[model samples]
Target chain A: MAAATESFTDQAIEVAGLKVRVMQGGRGSPVVVLHHSTGGPGWIPLFERLSAQHTVVAPDMPGYGQSERPEWAREPRDLAILMNAAIDRLGLTGVTLVGLGFGGFVAAEMATMNPSRLKALVLVGAPGLQPEEGEIADQMMVDYEDYVKAGFRDEAAYTAVFGETAAQDIKTLWDFSREMTARLTWKPYMFNRRLAPLLKEVRTPTLIVWGEKDAVVPPACGRQYKRALPNARLEVVAGAGHLVELEEADRVAKLIAAHAAQA
Target chain B: MFIGYFTERPYQDPSSGYFGATGRDLTDLGMSNASYDPRLGAELYNRYLDEKVYAEEMGFDGLMLNEHHSTPFCMGGVMNVEAAILARITKKAKIVLLGNVLPIWDDPLWLAEELAEIDMISRGRLVTGWVRGTGRESVAHNAQPPFNWERFQEAHDFVVAAWTRPGPFRWEGEHYNYRYVNPWSRPYQQPHPPIWIPGVMSRNTVAWAAKHRYPYVMLATELEPTRQSYQYYDDQAKENGYESGTQNRGYLFKVHVDETEELAEAAARKYIQGPSNPFLEGNQGNVRPFIQNLPGLTSRTNLLPTVQSFALAASRGRLKEHEAATGKKAEAATASADKQDAADFLGTFTDQINKMSIITGTPKTVIPKVRHVLEYLRPGSIFFWDGDGAMTHEDSMRSLRLMGEEVIPAVREMGKSLDLSSPFEVDPRTNQPVA
Candidate 1:
């Protein structure tokens, strides 16, 4: 068993014959963090908070960050299968999966594939289910910067994380991440039509977290997730956007921790 | 030389305030369909078609058409439909499509049938061309951007195989899958019509064209860089175990000739005035970088010379807008020296004329400039881009007449002297001196 640590370290682990870049820290019961379409936020404050009590493993979801891209992987389901393989290879048991936005879709898919493998699932501003109200915001229609900024509650929150102007390296990474997202989620524009029915079978205890002011993924998606999952409750974070985890890290982490512990 | 007449078939309406001098500097893709007046569209479409028929009568070897989507800059969103019209309307002129946007089509088999029918209708006067298309096409058509190149290659292969090969073969490619690949309409041209590839700054496309020994047509790029681009094609061809010649190269440039130089200049200036095109410099000058450069559409590393020049200009345009809004110069660090050079290069209309990017004059004056280009690039095919950017039908007719009467004869003599033979005259694939 890995010892509980304050800081995270990156390790290149092989899963499904592809090099997956995993950022791991802390140790106890396992919790894997799946990232959004703009790739993993890389041990953000939310992950750091969770790392205090849980073995947090955040891999850069293949074809994103430093992870090797598999040409065969097209949709979120393909990524879910690879992530399941990754969990199996890491020897994780009674895992509590945390997915943010697009990552939530992958986590939900993982839970559906093997409900017994997961102890709890936390979906933050996730967009797997189609909202009954407004649609999931089309990322392709707007500028990349605008799309990223749309995730935050306001400019201050965005500036705090990404500074005044994103560095060229960050821009490059965002472009790469967007390309991967486009590849996987272009046709349906985020949600799978079958995901709602698939989620009905995911019996894992679930927490559907959403930002009250989310402009990217509709807040109604949280309710949709709750309705889809048999044993799930919706928690809306006030004064936050789609990236609720980044905006209100402590609150989200507390909710996730409580859910994981209870499960 | 294969002298072809081309136009974008612009949907021009001056009253809409979407085009011309003093119009809003709207981005190319941002132009709304609300501005499109179908009454004007009806008049313009037929007028353009009439001009094409006249071009054949005036001695053009080919009538060229191109496609763009969701923009008023080009009304040929479904250009193959126009090609089908030309196949029936015109005689003794190759109905050249430069060309169908391959990546946008969900099924290339439909396109194969469409083109094959056009070829059969025209009795083998179809010079088929394919373009990977720009970011606008991908977005407007809802085509996958990351898989654009892959889809383009697959679609091209599928279309060619459908045309040449016998029916009912299975095609199991990544982007496209078919249980049975069969189309009743085979192309009229033996082994399918000649495939020509046109591009702006994509080196991958240029290399691909060279590898396949397809005629690589440089579209209104600057003279020096265009020569270098053709040289790159030549080098690629040599590496691919073949010697490239004039037949393997083509150049399309804006050339408007009038009875007088002043009239020609006035008409030529309209090229930048009508329906703001992001691709055209000194026009709208508002190229949304995100829209133009969709993620993974074109590789950043393998860019040609013009891309840097264009990028610099686009960035400078953005900086100018920033300054106008904020009342302050942007950070000096962002204003790199390359951008300064591009700012100077994308200068006034006179500067463009001096650069030979836009050649306009009386036939006698324009012929010498045309001679200079022919001598420099040695292209076997030349497309005179006329009647576009809000140019009146009368303006286009005059230019076409002058080109056919004076320019074409002179250029043909120049081609003879330069030993330039078009792809039709000398087959690009077999490297036959005269077909």
Candidate 2:
């Protein structure tokens, strides 16, 4: 993996009348990093690692973090459409698209809708497919604090992201993120029922990453995703829960960098 | 002061341990259908209906009904049906649906139509209410909690439009989308039936109710907190350039009358065994601190602390008094530690009766206390909660007869003397025009 720290600058861009905050870092081929349901920790260590080898364009999805949630952005497809417009407006073609958890579902939608926009696709502990065996946890029903706890393998990992006490601003951001997830994933519950079937249409070389002890999405979900996609590789990171990117940032960055380089 | 009769119509079979050791049977989403006894349920429904009918005859101004899902706490899963039935059965008392859970209703048009039919059937005696229901209700019905508020507002707007505005219109709300919105039957009351909202001091609700100029019914809340809630509503109303008063506020109370105060205390204990506080796990009217308020349901303004203070408030008042006298908390107070002192300090039968939390006495004793509550709250309306838990049908009817004969008459006179005007009296337009 490249250096763990890289300088990043925040920029706001208009896409379909919605303001999207994108964190741009390093200098190379663009790797659009889509955040999970918890939104962004702004420029994190994972982004730092990804930025060392490749230009990391991490945009806060509409209704998450700093992005404006349009009234029309009611579903995952709406988010996908907004994202597609955002990439096109930013002129980031042949981009390696990376998404985690809820964002992975949006990424899958984007790939299915417009596969040509991406050079490769990476999904880390995504929840767009429900396995017949283990079910995805109902993130909406649980308290925000509990949901945060469920994301990491240890409490120390939580403190790393949220410090000792999550300040009011961070708490508000999480609330907004949770609300957005509810809006998008509530009806079908974290997955589009048709997403599994739709995965076949995504010709982009896909990489599915699973946290070995993921209680939230479960490893079984990764298997289902692997079986459903036409051309995909599945890699499981040990000793990590749902927040694999944060827990094993260097390992995840290596996997993504290798996958994108091979593509 | 307008007084109404209310019951949760609880299925009174506490023998089953389906409620589990914690006594939080209702909050356990898995234990819903297990605890329900249809045989007992059928009897309870008719018996509760009978009690309400007798309450109307007892000169109560309204017959209050509320809805809750997947719990033995309230059998009015569909309160509108009961309201429709009571519309034909009762002659005078207004049928107040304290409300329908707005977010859970997939079709607001159907609700509007049903409410309209009930209003027409009762000759314009419907006081419509809408509520963002409990977290348990959301879990039971799978109504998404995040959309709870939006759905409530949208459904309310749609229902109101269905009644007031010429329909066959379009509604493209964020939560609800209807291409052709129309209802065949309009409400009997001209600008639609009066809107009442019941809440447990959610400041947002108080502000919303005040802005809309609707009556805010404080649901079985503590006296001082309820006064503050009413004042909050008044403050919001003043911001919108309206002077809200007793007419714009209401309170629900658990009241049961018996031959003696001791018997009334026994009945109050039985009340704790049922929906009133049974599923709440012995917390009698104090909502379980951990589970009652869901995240995102309440405002950031001391929501959790406020809910936690129910314990502090209950403890500070009765339990503290008990502690000071008995040298132990109510829970720790033993039988040998002066039963009378314990009763006075703890939420014992005598203690509750003394505190006026559960008004239980002969008509002579109960009337004065009822008047005191009426004077204190000075509500536009009061809901006389007559039955729940194991309180027998005969006992409930007896209480009603006593209330009709004595308690209500005295309360009405007290209302007159205190210069308290009900919403119905102040806003006569809510009443149906006589044919």
TM, chain A, every candidate: 0.96, 0.95
Error of 2 at A63 (Å): 1.8
Each predicted complex: what DockQ? 0.68, 0.23
Please give, for residues B1-435, the per-residue lDDT of candidate 1 as tens digits: 899999998888888877666557567676678777889999989999999999999899999999999888888999999999999988789988998999999988899999999999999999999998877899999898888899999999999999888888999998888999888889998898888998877889999999999999999888877888899999999999999999999999989999998899989988877773557766654666676777778765555656333453243233343333223344442445345335534556787788887899999899999999999999999999998786899999999999888999998999999989999889989898653
In model 1, where do residues sit more than 4 Å from their true spots?
A1-6, B22-25, B307-309, B312-341
Prediction 1 TM-score vs. true: 0.95
Docking band of candidate 2: acceptable
lDDT of each: 0.85, 0.76
Best by TM-score: 1
